[model samples]
Target: MDLEVRHLRVVCAIADAGSITKAAAGLGLSQPSLTAQLRRIERYLGGPLFVRSRQGASPTALGEFVLAKARTVLPSIDAIQVESALRAGAAPDRRPLRYVATPGPLMVGLLEELRELFPGASPALRTETHVPTAVDLIASGQQDLAAVVEYLRPVPVPPPPDVVARTVATEPAFVLLPAGHPFATRPAVGLAEFADAEWVLPPNQACGLFEAFTAACVDAGFTATIRHEAESSAARELVARGTAVGLGQATFRSTPGIVPLPLAGCPLLIRQVLLWHRDGPLAAHAREITEGAERAYAAAVRRSPHYLAWLAERPPPGAEQGWAGAGDAPP
Candidate 1:
């Protein structure tokens, strides 16, 4: 049989499932049927794909080579299919309120508030934390709006030429610690205190956040020792289990056995920015949308005592913190 997308899928399924029996079950095929198909594919490809063992199946050198190509081709195909379906069904008179965002639980309530503003236009959010990906999507006209964060302290994260952004709010970053950690009870921690501590940095790279964090640590007189990189849940687990400490958003949720603390001097501050292509569809509404996002951010800030306390000490960015002032004026 000639190799095809289906053949590539079968190879990927087998590699992902790690065994023929499991792959067969996952693909809804009998073990013998899947094995015969796999044998044919191996013959077509000129080598054995997976080596069978008592533990499980593992890809051989040629299998790894084929798997790499399959993984790349699959997502591109999925994207094309999704785009085609959307275009095929899209209405002529109505437009959806499309926006991109990063991974943040705080965005749940914010999204709800935003939906009310653009009535009849169902906005589908695409979550993207990688700086280039968000910028590229906006620049290419794939998405015109995004609610993104930029590290504004120690080093300011500059937006690319393709996009323009206005600061919605500047929120202080917090540190996540195990409940039993020595510094958990401390009202605040000095950046230098974590100098020798193993850290779990944010998974995002090339976004300037990682660079800004490392820069802050260096300014505090030592380089941070980053032992792991992961998403929020894994970072929490690592912190809770006393494996590695990590940074948290100011509006970070109250997780049991975890303490989120402010860093003294407020070395790390994240500016919640509303981004759009400078000349794209959202350009006209950029200020208004940014203001609306700020209102949601204001309500979100109320959930965190740290944000409230921080506001009390310093002036809120972009005119005001509440809907009355910040939301009323365009920055």
Candidate 2:
């Protein structure tokens, strides 16, 4: 079989995730399919590229060499595509603006801003449950812009060369518990306070949030007993009905029977990012979209009474500054 950029990406994903199961999730592929593909690639190369163990898979010598070359080649290829698109004036004025995002209240606010920014230009919207998939869509020119959530630890995965990403906001995660649950009325609760509580967390493949949530639970000296798996609306519904507790953004709207509390010590954080093809039709509006996202987040913060109270107790420096200036382009 011939090697391709997509195949190279598969290899990199496996190396980075350290396991086929996790890598498949990141790639939006099934584990079994990815495993079979790996076997074929290995056969084509005449040797195994990974050493699998109970913990995960590690690259073999040949795998390391190939991966190293892939890292260099893929980015260059991406750059060429971007440059070509730019020179070709890829932005088509007739096409409706395409926007994709991970599900959340933040997206609602962003869409509102978009409407105000481009009057009469209704953008096409898609909700991707996985951040990497949303990013890949933008990188592949399948979407014009994407709003994704990422964790700040272990370093965020870099955007593909064809894409440019900027951080619109960084906010601490809040705990959502049953309104009558103990510590629900507290101003702020530490992770340890919920060590024994049942968690309704999104699957790890949803984004880095899952991993961060698990790590925080471990740091608090207990493994979280995740009883349900859902993301966005479903997760919120479970928390609201008092079926299980979950984590949410600071701007989480409190529904009846649901209490959102700031995590004391702020051990977990979620970064909201906007990504778009660097040379695509939407590139010209990148700054505007980024600014809109920040404004939307700031508005959400102001709307959340619980978040407001937490900010009042220990205000972050420049808390009052509008979020427009808070954005920074990710490397």
Candidate 3:
């Protein structure tokens, strides 16, 4: 019995979480079901793939060897799917580009840009946040593309082993305050000055951004008081009403009643990146959509005096190399 892609995926998830139960939950499968899948794979390989202990499950030496091979073949499955879809006459516009994003000012122009560039294309967009779910959705083929803004220090995420990442932009952190707040008059402020101030942040997957925000405050010798946890727009509302001060990216759109102050000496700026499956060749429409996103990103940056500085030549940090056929313009 040859081990299949499903089996390898189950095994890889187990290795990643180091617990079969957690892995099952992460992959949205029952523990028994996942266990059964693993058992069959081990039987086919004629060896134990994971070593179970009080500490949890760790891939055995044999398991690691098998996984290395599985990794190589897993991507081919996605390629096969793409080819099948293409042969069936899946045009780019009609073909869904499964996209997952967190609603923020950065993404405001993304969809419009896609519409402008690929007029006939209709993207299937879903909203998700938190790094883990976003990564899993892409890996599981639930999403074809994703937009992400992560903390300055790297979070524990699997390397883009089966996916491709493109860094579109980086936004310096800003302290958003009520329009008339005392600090609003200051040209810039440091995180330490707001150590005791109440803060509002994004919820859902955007929750992970707080981790980096907190870490930066830790470095600054103070703890942030979280007043609310919701979407970026909600946070903006909170700051506008003087409920709390909050962090924001340069890509954010300003609400009339709030002002943004530069967070001096804070290295916790948001790094935005786009992700897609490496195994699948992008459809012409999807390619056009991404190019449109690039243009949108470029225009949005140009419209903002602060972000315009990033528009210069050198690549923004964490910006992955562009896709082979997906360039600055549509093919």
Best by TM-score: 2
Tell me the lDDT of model 3 at 270.
Answer: 66
How far in Å is the alpha carbon of 25 misplaced in model 3?
21
lDDT of 2: 0.74
lDDT string, candidate 1, 1-331, tens digits = 7898778888988887899999999889999999999999999999999999987889999999998887656544533443343445442142355678875532555567556655444657778868667766665445657766666544344556656666666667888999999998888899999989999977874555787688789899998889999877788899999998998777787788888888998787676666666555556555556667767877777877766776787775441221223222245
Error of 3 at 252 (Å): 1.1
Instruction: For model 2, give the 10-residue run with minimal summed lDDT.
Output: 317-326
lDDT (Cα atoms) of all candidates against the true structure: 0.71, 0.74, 0.66
**Clash statistics: count for each candidate:** 0, 0, 5
Per-candidate TM equals: 0.66, 0.66, 0.63
- Scored by lDDT, model 1 comes in at 0.71
Could you give candidate 2's per-residue lDDT for residues 169-258 as a string of tens digits? 677788888887878878888899787789887777546766677777788899889899886678888887878999887778868778
TM-score of candidate 3 against the unseen true structure: 0.63
**Candidate 3 lDDT, 1-331, residue by residue in tens:** 7756678778878987899999999889998998888898888988999998889899999999977776666545655654455445454422454567765543556766644443433556677657667766676555666776665554534335556655556567777889989888776777888988998887746334666777788889988888788676787778888998887777656578888777775456565666666665443345655666677777766666544543352344442222212322223
Error of 1 at 150 (Å): 1.5
Highest lDDT: which candidate? 2
Which stretches of model 3 miss by more than 4 angstroms? Answer: 1-95, 105-108, 112-121, 154-160, 204-208, 283-291, 303-331
